[model samples]
Target: MSFDYEKYIRPGKLPHIWCPGCGHGIVMKGLIRAMDALGMKKNNTAIVSGIGCASRLPGYIDCCTLHTTHGRAVAFATGIKMAKPEMQVLCVGGDGDGVAIGGNHFIHACRRNINITYLIMNNNIYGMTGGQFSPTTPTGAKASTTPYGNPDPPFDIAKLAIGAGATFVARGTAYHANQIEKLLVEAIRHKGFSVVEILDSCPTTYGRRNRFRSVVEMMNNLKEIAVSVQAAEHMSPEQMQGKVLTGVLYRDNRPEYVEEYQKVIEAAQDFAG
Candidate 1:
């Protein structure tokens, strides 16, 4: 059955600002499908984003949305979650916005195990900022700032989230639209902090600089390199080189911050009584 995506999108916001062939639109559609599948009420859900091309998504979504300062989406989302623990809060950001300038808040949110979901659009370059190499940009990849090719090693966002103590961590690509939606639904249902890293393509910026013939070529590359976690288990290390392991990377049952704080409040009331 076809989903009514218009129900979730703001009507006047049609003809979004993203460039033609940009993968951000696919990621946004996946998110909308996930919300529909979960039957999330717009009134009870909040979307937050920082300054970037990908952050513009909230402007098109029909929900309580916050367009925050650069690299501050997580901080603002944290305040919203604390103020209304019953509401579903989601933070959307680009690779540079979340993993570079906002790296501190990102890890702390994971360590605290807050009941919030973070969807990071990792396109490997600062698409809105002249195509500079981002934290997740592959080593030796050409970018506006690295015309000679980037020499720095890129950070694996999934590994970083797991190391920072996120309760749930997963990876998906824009090429796998259905899988992205499924992973998002599970992430939203998880009790503690959840991070879903989406490997999206910025055809206008990253693709042109990387010598991709077209958006289809870039997408095909993603499909070729992305391997499910289960399939990866059967491959040798040498064979796994240059492959991106997708699917749920890690998960654990941990005490969420809001629930733990409520316990303290209950204990204090009991003592007073």
Candidate 2:
């Protein structure tokens, strides 16, 4: 079967706000392709986003989109999913939105195992907010706010999601276009809470401040520093110190919160009888 993206893209929004070398565009394409492959109905799907360049995804998609307050997309999406379980709810946001201001919501949503897909664009800095350090920024990565080099360790997003009770967790990068799309399709199809961390580039903020020279150089570094699960297990402390994991790091079958809630309602009626 063939799918037409033009039909689902909002008109007059062709010129995106991201920088020339930004990776959000690649991630967006992956998502659109995955939805099309899954044959998701645009009307039946809802895209929720928080404040950030990545959050603008909802505005570009031709669907029931909600560009909500900063770091609150997950919370808002939770309500929407509970009210309408059949909706194909997807949340998009940046590292700052998902793991900094919204960190609490991110973990709780995973623990609740709400049936929703969260695509976190982890560009390592707050690109939309002037290149500030985020929860996912490396310990030594330079940012506008971290002039003398960062002092805090970055959060491994996939590991956090897995530990927080996300039934499905995956990691991909803008360079791995095909893998991202495939993973997104599986994430959306998963019956429990799913999280995919897409490592992206911020040419203007992170690139310039960190001496990346260009977006292509940043991507090359990403490819070189990334490690697979199997490779990570064999690496020593020195080798693993600066490494990042990619691919489907973890997944499992768990009872979803919404499905369990319905069961409770059914049990209550039986007890009343």
Q: Estimate the overall C-alpha local distance difference test score of candidate 1.
A: 0.95
Q: Give the candidate number with the greatest TM-score.
A: 1
Off by over 4 Å in 1: none
Candidate 1 residue-wise lDDT at 77: 94
Question: Please, what are the lDDT tens digits per residue for candidate 1 over residues 1-273?
Answer: 677999999988989989998889999999999999999999999999998999999999999999999999989999999989999999998999999998999999999999999999999999997799999999999999999999999999999999999999999999999999999999999999999999999999899989999999999999999999999999999999989999999999999999998999999999999
State how far residue 256 of model 1 sits from its true place (Å).
0.5
Model 2 Cα shift for residue 198 (angstroms): 0.6
TM-score of 2: 0.95
Full-model lDDT for every candidate:
0.95, 0.91
Error of 1 at 73 (Å): 0.8
lDDT of 2 by residue, 1-273 (tens): 565778779999888888898999999999999998899999999999999999998899999999999999999999999999989999999999998899999999999999999999999999987899998888988998899999999898888999999999999898887888998999999999999999998989998988898788988977887887778888898998867788888889989999999999899999999
Question: How does candidate 1 fare on TM-score?
Answer: 0.98
Question: What's the true lDDT of residue 88 in model 1?
Answer: 99
TM-scores for all candidates: the values are 0.98, 0.95
Clashing pairs in 1: none
Q: After superposition, how far is residue 241 of candidate 1 from its true place, in Å?
A: 0.4
